[model samples]
Target: KWRGYGVATADFGRADVTWSTQFIGKATDFNADPGDLGYRTPNVFYHNVQFAYDLFEKTRLMVGIDNLFDRKPPFIQSWTDANTDTMTYDLLGRRYYASFRHLF
Candidate 1:
């Protein structure tokens, strides 16, 4: 089982500047064979990042991101006619998201 992790930090001695980063990975299994249904990768990755700071000691600002890779499993393999080449049955691409939070 493969496992990993990462972290980043930033310090603002006086003003309030902060930055952070993170990454992780795990390759725990292998398909060996797909048989029929379709081929897939046993390895998957999950990662995210968050940025935050104080606005007025009472209010705070923050942003978060998820699914940095946005990878999807392949539903089909190679073939013609009996299988046919399709732009629809393949894997998905990367996705991005942005978010903000408030405190009460």
Candidate 2:
């Protein structure tokens, strides 16, 4: 199982900034075989940042922070409740978000 996601954005017309990255590659646990020992499960990266402003004509505000340096999910032994591999990873390590938007 491999995944990837990278995004970068910046603007100065109404205040805007964003940075995101989430990649999870390197997995080998087909029931654990071939000299078992956790089989293999390494490679994880997660970081996110967002900021938006436009609290005026229309109203708009946003803030975000997801797993930005607080990542922990690299243990999968056929999946055991919370041992890791909770649907790909990311077990809510770091998260902070806010959003508000209006339009007429």
Candidate 3:
């Protein structure tokens, strides 16, 4: 399957607008991840956005949006000896965070 892509915004003397939305089948739940739950794979839609600016010398301000669509990891399988599921969990949801860096 295939989709489409386009630009968001572009302006000088100000922050640039950049974004991307993709729906991909991404699954990762094995024995080495954060949680060890048998084998669970789920379809995921990812999104990303970034707003950057050069504040000062070696100082940069970056505001990024990850998982903007609130995409979450697939539900992990339950391995219980009681022949029933006791605990189950999934990945985090859409997160909005900011970050700053100094390349000094």
Q: What residue pairs are clashing in model 2?
A: none
lDDT tens readout by residue for model 1, 25-91: 2221233244554443244454555566665655666555554455453333344433422432223
lDDT for model 2, on a 0 to 1 scale?
0.87
Q: List the candidates' TM-scores in order.
A: 0.42, 0.41, 0.47
How far is 58's C-alpha from truth in model 3 (Å)?
A: 2.5
Per-residue accuracy of model 2 over 10-48 as CA lDDT, tens digit each: 998888999999899988888878556668888899989
Candidate whose lDDT is highest: 2
**Model-by-model lDDT, in order?**
0.42, 0.87, 0.56
lDDT value, residue 54 of candidate 1:
62
The positional error of residue 59 in candidate 1, measured at the CA in angstroms, is 2.5
**Cα RMSDs of all predictions?**
8.2, 8.3, 8.7
Alpha carbon deviation, residue 104, candidate 2 (Å): 36
- Best candidate, TM-score-wise? 3
